[model samples]
Target: MERLEKSIVITLCNLEKIFPPSFFTIMIHLVVHLASEAKVAGPVHYRWMYPIERYLLTLKKYVRTRSHPEGSIAEKYLADKSMTFCSRFLHNVETKSNRTERYFDGYYGASTHTSLTKLEHGQVHRYIIFNLDIIEIFRNLHIEDLKQRYVYDMINHFHIIDISFSYLFNIYV
Candidate 1:
């Protein structure tokens, strides 16, 4: 605003000879108040309507019908809020499901009994876990029963890669 005031004063002084004195009466006086506004309000952008503009943009997305935009946005907003409030108590409340199979819901592993030619003992291996959520649950329930089930499933289903840990926890817990 100080910069703005400086620019305005410089413009007025430079154009004093060319234009009539009456040309800089009302608007130029308004420009002079910008310096005082900076002292009171801190900055021009903060005092502006950016927050209201952003809120209006959010409301605009809820507008479906062109004929009655206000009604459309109001109804849609209320419906979404009500659904959000209601979904709190629901079980298996998946908001987004990009996968066809939710394999992470149960215990899963792979194993085989076929031995290589010269090995005296079975070769032990660790599975590469892809799902972090499954890994977290595995860490949380790292007790004897679930760990045993994991080993059993891995030995039984070595040829197949997928494993489900669902029922193992349900039975023990």
Candidate 2:
């Protein structure tokens, strides 16, 4: 924004010099405020009439007869809603309402097994350590306690990693 603001102002200033003062109307000045206004109000879809307009357009498409659009829209809407309501109980057959997300991740409660390389494992650990937001004082105290305990036990790093993760795997499976 800092960089873009300078360019926007410069362009507007250039236009001011190129044209008469009367050319700079309220609408022209409002161009500078669009980005800031969108930031304050959030994306256009959330704050604007876009979703409502889209739904109305869909309803408009339901109009089959020129005599009464309201009746056609109402009839089609009720049919669609009733079918959606029924589609939930239809486990055997595929339906619009029961379709998976665009990028499907397999069926619900299903998962894939993955093996992480040592470098990938270290990267993940580093990411969590840097990004996790536990209270700083508590985290420091926990780390100090672990250091003291591990140092007192004089356990080698390899021995710690040798600890079996089978107990965790057993519980999950």
Candidate 3:
């Protein structure tokens, strides 16, 4: 737990350079620390940690549906492009299944294209890149503080984005 706290402190300090000290950054760090600790601890910890996980999960779901009124044009563009790339990739995978059927002959493929199309893949992708961009922006804003925050922030941010994306996708499809 000491190691986790140290890492979170280092991450918070690093993020502080670009993000301006805010509860948002602190919550993000705390959520990440708890997530990591939960993984190492047993099911009892998971049961105890349910409230935190549930809160984070709720935040993620809200973020997924909410519009980004403050996002820059470039950020929007990258997100759209990433979503397009992912959608196209999913489409290709679904359509090309039979092209390599020898290996998956008996396996059944469920059709999900219709549901997938309804998903705001662009927004989902954008949310992810936006989180990553936060770290990059922080790094660029304070190169001198690189070591103090980069690794843990990047890891936590990525994990959060991934969890959020998965949650949204599960709901969408």
Candidate 4:
């Protein structure tokens, strides 16, 4: 613990040497006090307000009425609490909490297993590649490179066939 404090002090002093004094804000200054605070409080996670802040944020979302936010939040909170309690007792009803998980149930009408056939996989892969705007320039550059490489008669013949095949499978389709 003492070594850690010394290490932090040395590190902060080194940082001070490299960066201007004005760059050290309150947050940066707070780092020097963290080791002592951790020693006093045991651990940072035990003292975090994230869960309470998150729940408060959720409650804030329940406020539908602009003029009477407090009343809206209170009413929604009560309604949600009652609904949750009722859902616990009702086995047949499809409350949000009681519904099967989306992953297992395939709730979006998608298949549970994404086992595509080879042709389907190829089509999907080709669709994604062709749709990417950044790759269009690269694709054109590659076709130019192929034309340069296959300038000989026999290779040029194969290149013509390849070009016709690519034209048949154009984006215009």
TM-score of the candidate numbered 1? Answer: 0.33
The candidate with the higher lDDT, 2 or 3, is 2
lDDT of 4 by residue, 6-28 (tens): 79878988999999999988888
- Between prediction 3 and prediction 4, the one with superior TM-score is 4
Candidate 1 Cα errors over 4 Å, as ranges: 1-35, 43-46, 96-173
Minimal lDDT window, size 10, model 1: 121-130
Q: Candidate 2, residues 1-173: lDDT per residue as tens digits?
A: 55665577889999999999999989998878776776678777677888899998999898997699889899999998999999999998889977878897766876889999997986675555435675344445544555676684543353342232223223433
lDDT top scorer: 4
Deviation in Å, model 3, residue 126 alpha carbon: 55
Residue runs of model 4 more than 4 Å from their true location after superposition: 16-24, 105-173
Q: Between prediction 1 and prediction 4, which has the larger lDDT? A: 4
How do these models rank on lDDT, best leading? 4, 2, 1, 3
Candidate 4 clashing pairs, residues 3+ apart or interchain: none
User: The CA-based lDDT of model 1 is what?
Assistant: 0.63
List the global CA lDDT of all models.
Answer: 0.63, 0.70, 0.55, 0.76
Residue-by-residue lDDT tens digits, candidate 3, 4-110: 75577677667667674554643575555674665577456446778898966654544432466334444655676676666666745553332455666565777
lDDT by residue (tens digit), candidate 1, 1-173: 56776787777677887889988677666766777778888977887998999989999999999999989999999998887767665657654233236556754667659865533332222232324565556534543344565665654453433233333434544
lDDT of 2 at 128: 52
Clashes of 3: 0
